[model samples]
Target: MDKLKKNEKWFWGGVVLIELILFYSSSMTYKQQTSVPFLEKYVHGKPLKSSLSQIHFNYGGKEQSIANDGYYHFVEFFIRKGAHFGTYLILAVFLCLALYTYFKKNHFLNVFVPWLMTTGLAAFDEFHQGLTGGRTPSVTDVILDSAGALTGALIVVIITYFVIRHKNVKKV
Candidate 1:
């Protein structure tokens, strides 16, 4: 049993390490971080050029071209926010798992601790981005990341509740 627990710890630790790698890689230059490569070729007229190109927009009965037009910016915004949400989501999930595995009780602690830790990590990530070239830190991103983490943690909590309820039913 101890060996199994140890292995689980290592596995979740690896998941966390991968999330760190993703967070760090995301802090690199804009060109270094490419999201949705498959959509790039089809949407941008070429590969590696989704957020880097100017797009056309129709606004208030007038047509205009902007670096980040309505459609393009919308897509780019989603991509960036999705990345933030996903990375933090994974982090929170693994964190909650690890904490719960270790403690095995205290539901509130298991949930809130992971949320707080993930939120702090998100803030640190933005601070790290500020130190990198071509990257600027934004509090809004931190908020987005926190929301993502909270969502991930909530999902785990819900699943755990169901699993425990099912087990209790079986016992009854």
Candidate 2:
């Protein structure tokens, strides 16, 4: 309709695209997975874990470290956990943004479209991981992603319902 509205579409479109890129980047496991700079600090100077540190490095290029053990292992475990939780937040954001856009145009499918897109994106991410060096597709991740989308949809619907009701009450 106007420039502002058109720009809004582009803005949200970028958000979706960037999120996809981040999702893929975070899941991939390559040689340098553990050679993270901060991780290297743990090695103390030998370029290897201390005898007490039970670390697992995927590839030995002095980069790309996957934690097989030690504190690094703990970090890796928590990172995965955190990633899943963040995925839920992203799903919610995308669905909310999409519905907001659709509302401006009276698009009845807006709510449904977000869920469809979110799942499709999750499936794509899982599939992409399958092709990566050391990554496998997990049905669990997809389920979590979908669950996040569902939660987002329900939240928006509930919020909107209450807002409309409150407005009517005020008018009366």
Candidate 3:
């Protein structure tokens, strides 16, 4: 392979490594995970929701807390799920790029491989979370993660199709 090809592979490999590091970091205790900038701001004080009407759901049969200091847990829940989506989306992008660089031209491989890889990783991530002291693993999160990966892969497919079409047009 050419130098550029090698460099691209290295770039994708680095992305995967960074993702793994993130996965490991997420395996930390709830306290460790919440010690970050924005979360730290609402870590302590009185419970935010006084009435049951404020909105919250049970995780592992235990009611999730709306934060102290009046931060709505409903908002936090979506933010957390959104983070999962964003991370998997990035993972899918890199995975698709790497596969395109290395594999033969095949529409199925381009989509299926990345989707399978991402879904598997998401499952493993949930399993890891289950092992963590305060984290609860949810199949719903796995579905959300897979959907994100699929969306990312589809975006790449659309862009690649247009790029290839443009190249052919230039050749014509």
**Reference-based TM-score of each model:** 0.74, 0.59, 0.75
Total clashing pairs in model 1: 0
What are the RMSDs of all candidates, in order?
Answer: 6.3, 8.0, 4.8
- Candidate 3 Cα RMSD after full superposition onto the native fold (Å): 4.8
Residue 106 miss distance in model 1 (angstroms): 1.9
Model 1 residue 26 distance off true place after TM-score fit, in angstroms:
3.8
Which wins on TM-score, candidate 1 or candidate 3? 3
- In model 2, the clashing pairs are 31-64, 32-63, 32-64, 33-64, 33-65, 34-64, 34-65, 35-65
In the predicted model 1, the residue pairs found to clash are: none
Candidate 2 lDDT, 20-137, residue by residue in tens: 7756675768554544456557645443345425544432233223334445554554466466556655665555565564563433454566767777777887788788777767
lDDT (0 to 1) per candidate: 0.72, 0.60, 0.73
Off by over 4 Å in 2: 1-11, 23-27, 30-75, 101-112
* Per-residue lDDT over 1-172 for candidate 1, one digit per residue giving the tens place of the 0 to 100 score: 2443566776478557956786777579766775445444568644334553455554334444435344444465557778888988888888877766764566777678889988998898788888889987878788888998898888878888788789789999
After best superposition, candidate 3 residue 18: deviation in angstroms? Answer: 3.6
Ten consecutive residues with minimal summed lDDT in candidate 2?
58-67
Candidate 3, which ten residues in sequence have the lowest lDDT sum?
66-75
Candidate 2's error at 110, in angstroms? Answer: 5.5
Which structure among the candidates has the greatest lDDT?
3
